[model samples]
Target: MDTTALLWLIGAAGSGKTATGWAVFRELAAAGVRAAFVDGDQVGMAYPAPPGDRDNEHVKARGLGALWAGYRAAGVQCVVAAGGVGTAATVADFAAQVPGAAMTVVELTVDAAERQARLIGRGSADLVEPAAALAAAFDRAPLTEHRVDTGGRTVDEVARLVLDRVGRPAAGAGPWPPRRFPAPEPIAGERVPLLWVCGATGVGKSTVAFPVFLALLAAGERAAYIDLAQVGWARPEAPGDPGGHLLRARNFGALWRSHRAAGSRVLVVSGSGGGPADMRRYLDAVPDCDPLVVRLDARPDVLAERVLMRSKGIGVELPGDELRGLAGADLDRAVAAAQAEAVRLAADGVGAVHLDTSDRSPEQLAAGIHARLVRRGGGAAAP
Candidate 1:
């Protein structure tokens, strides 16, 4: 009898769901408890908004289901999922995706002052009021078997608090090593094609890149897509691991290899290369690969509007990068940075192909890039 379970952490934005959930799962994994961590935002990354799914919760949950199946098959005992899920229907939607696992809902709460402090710390002071509104909504209809107070507590402290109620699981073997996937045997003169979409923030890097990946699949290519930032997320970073680079690199290597082993011949990476060094790290991860870089850009106003839409959409869905921009001055700063990044990328000619996204829909942009990819010998080779 399988006794797999899930700790479903629900909270408003900035409630520490991700930080705490990461801490809890890392703690469990250290003991080789066969645990896996899933960030709702990370798994359900898509573009052009999936028609009627507002928060993208539906897709996020579905993605979780697929990942959970793989994890369970690989001998994982349980999963810790952290996201903003308020209504019973939403919870049910998530639980249905993880069949046979008992779901425990835990809400994380924070007071106004504490929330403000955290928001300000993150340069998202604009979120304080919006977060308060979200908190009020959660309060109006509380959803949780247990509530954990995150105010004035470190992420580990919150994790401990949750563990106090849920109790720790029995330990497994020593710390778990990275799971190996069955890779296809290499052939002489064979190289996988890697398409990396790079750009300024809000330039539609993810939005455009995802559709290209899908188009490749449509063309009968085994394709895999990853958001560079999403994969590298781990807490308690060492000074040398700024922005969790070291951790993300390690994780990215493992994921890329797994995708390769799974017989994917094309890789579409959606990321903004901070510089040559950052890009180099990811390039080194793939073996026998031809890399194609496409940079997406938009006018300043267009970029601002897009960033604001992602940052302030009460229930809007984005490609798993939760912190894009905030409201008010924070938004201004984000837009400025994105705009400046666009100019820099243009001057640097970082991408072999530059696509303007100001007036182009994601689908159109993807089509253009895919055509270019085919020309560059990065698309599915004739088969």
Candidate 2:
């Protein structure tokens, strides 16, 4: 059988169906899997607004069938879609778009408070009307066999779950290649140490890195926050670029050396430090720096809650069921993954520290990391 699947995520606003589905698309893409994501809301814009009924014929002809057909022709194996699909008929409408396609319909749900909070954060004006309709419809509509609660989970975690159900990221497979960077200039300066802050998704890596960057400067040290996410991945690149990690490492090494030549004293970078190879890839970027790896730690529940709340603020409202998954099974998997990676990192015997931020604030986490870096000559003392 051809390895093809279709995932239709149905849910109301703040249910996290769309974002979670999108995450799945990205995950598959990163794995070099031919996948397509059809956003029902975006596609709906091509046609006029629907009438009073959401399940009417006019609304159902939103070109989803045509879209899926196009994707199938292009050799796309997996199709993921999400939007305001509330009825069984709507699910059938979507399925009809791609004949003989393996389809899975998932209903994502969330608590009222979380939905309201997300609606408010996303600037979803007229929340009361949508909230009431969602509540009534959920109660009246027939539940699907696959229902997910998205209350406190990270998008990555949820995406992983969906992919697992679809049997993706084949065993022993690595992620798609890391993004590429251009060669940086060679510069000379005194050797500076690197404070590497890294952990699983939603462990406050970015949140804590910024504060640590600032703290280093406040302590009268020359420091720069090198966010790996923003570095090589932001720009468009060619397909199947395998030299991304090497280029990114060279670029970081050049950037650090240049900064040091200009009197910069320390390097603070946040990114993949899960294992020896990940750490080596980054450390190789700045060859002269002694590396102080700090792995941020948190329980799965805590990590999921943090990631979901952050997503809401950023305008992605997740469902409570999805959050629950994050807090429960998803969270368990995430914690286990992080623990395994930490153990792998420990084999290096580089005095790496795993700091749990489950009960700590970002400020506290930053301060703790800052103290450690200062002691190691990674940066100046916090003022």
The lowest-lDDT stretch of 10 consecutive residues in candidate 1 is 232-241
For each candidate, the alpha-carbon lDDT, in order, equals 0.71, 0.61
Clashes of each: 2, 16
Clash count, predicted structure 2: 16
TM-score of model 2 (CA atoms):
0.44
RMSD after Cα superposition, model 1: 10.5
Kindly list the per-residue Cα lDDT of model 2 for residues 289-343, writing each as its tens digit.
Answer: 7778777777766765665665445423322212223555665665556555545
TM-score of each: 0.57, 0.44
**Candidate 2 C-alpha error for residue 353, in Å:** 1.3
Please, what are the lDDT tens digits per residue for candidate 1 over residues 1-383?
44677888888878999888877888876665767677877655443234566666766676566556545544556678888875678888888877778778889998888888887877788778768887898888887758889987888899999988888877644433343433323333478788899998777777788778888877777667778766643322334545544445445555555455445677788877576676676666565678888888888888888877778653324324544447777777877888898888888778877778888888888887888888887775332
Question: Model 1, 274: alpha-carbon shift in Å?
Answer: 1.3
lDDT of 2 at 367: 88
Question: Candidate 1 regions off by >4 Å?
Answer: 1-37, 40-164, 167-189, 314-325, 380-383
